[model samples]
Target: MQFHIPAGVGEGMQLTVSGKGNTLGRHGGINCDLLVVIQEEKHPELERDGNDPIYNLNISIPDAILSNTTEIPTAEGRAKIK
Candidate 1:
């Protein structure tokens, strides 16, 4: 089933949806609550520190010599970092 998730939600968080689980015993009986466990997908260039995401960028020697803005990946998309 599909559900809405808000921003800044961390891993291992639990959410409960009422009346969305299997029936208690028989048909038309009381329904159980569904538990949703949040799991985070691994990011190739990022690491997790609690709720914060850390990205370590390595630049080439030539590019380091000449200062320029570089595009990096973010949760909202790509961002430029100087």
Candidate 2:
């Protein structure tokens, strides 16, 4: 089955659908709104700080002391940083 997610959807954002929950009492007179919770899993290569993502890089002592250009992985793609 296909699902439709809106273009403006982002992390911590919530969408509510009316009258999707169970009814109260046997007669089903009152309907309750469904409480949907949205959760995003943690990324293996990055950590989140507010809305930004942080990447940690480990370099050797020689590389740290010397000037070098290294390739690092990011959410977008591989990036080269000096």
Candidate 3:
């Protein structure tokens, strides 16, 4: 699956991922993992010391899946079944 992230995510912004899928009328949802990184501005003094500043981030999916009681097709009904 592909995700479209919103723009203007700089410095401090809460990032979230959510989506849903259906199989035989049953709905399911998933929370994806994400990683955020921030870069620090360059400094001449830091360069002399051979030190580079960079931020590392780790994020986990809050929810792996969600189940629904309704029956739903795996594929879209409007399109012909492959």
TM of each candidate vs. truth: 0.73, 0.51, 0.21
lDDT of each: 0.84, 0.72, 0.36
| For model 3, the run of ten residues with the poorest summed lDDT | 73-82
Q: Which tens-of-lDDT digit does each residue in 1-82 have in candidate 2?
A: 2234565355677766566778878986787776555677767788777767788798888888886889987877789988
lDDT of 3: 0.36
Q: Candidate 3 at residue 60, lDDT?
A: 35
Using TM-score as the measure, the top candidate is: 1
Provide the RMSD of all predictions against the true structure, rounded to 1 decimal: 2.6, 4.9, 26.5
Shift of residue 56 alpha carbon in model 3, Å = 29
Model 2, C-alpha of 55: deviation from truth (Å): 1.5
TM-score-best of 2 and 3: 2
User: Which residue pairs show collisions in model 2?
Assistant: none
lDDT per residue for candidate 3 within 1-82, as digits (tens), equals: 5656564344444454443233233364443445434343443322212232333223334322332233222212222221
Give the candidate number with the greatest lDDT: 1
Candidate 3 shows a clash count of 5
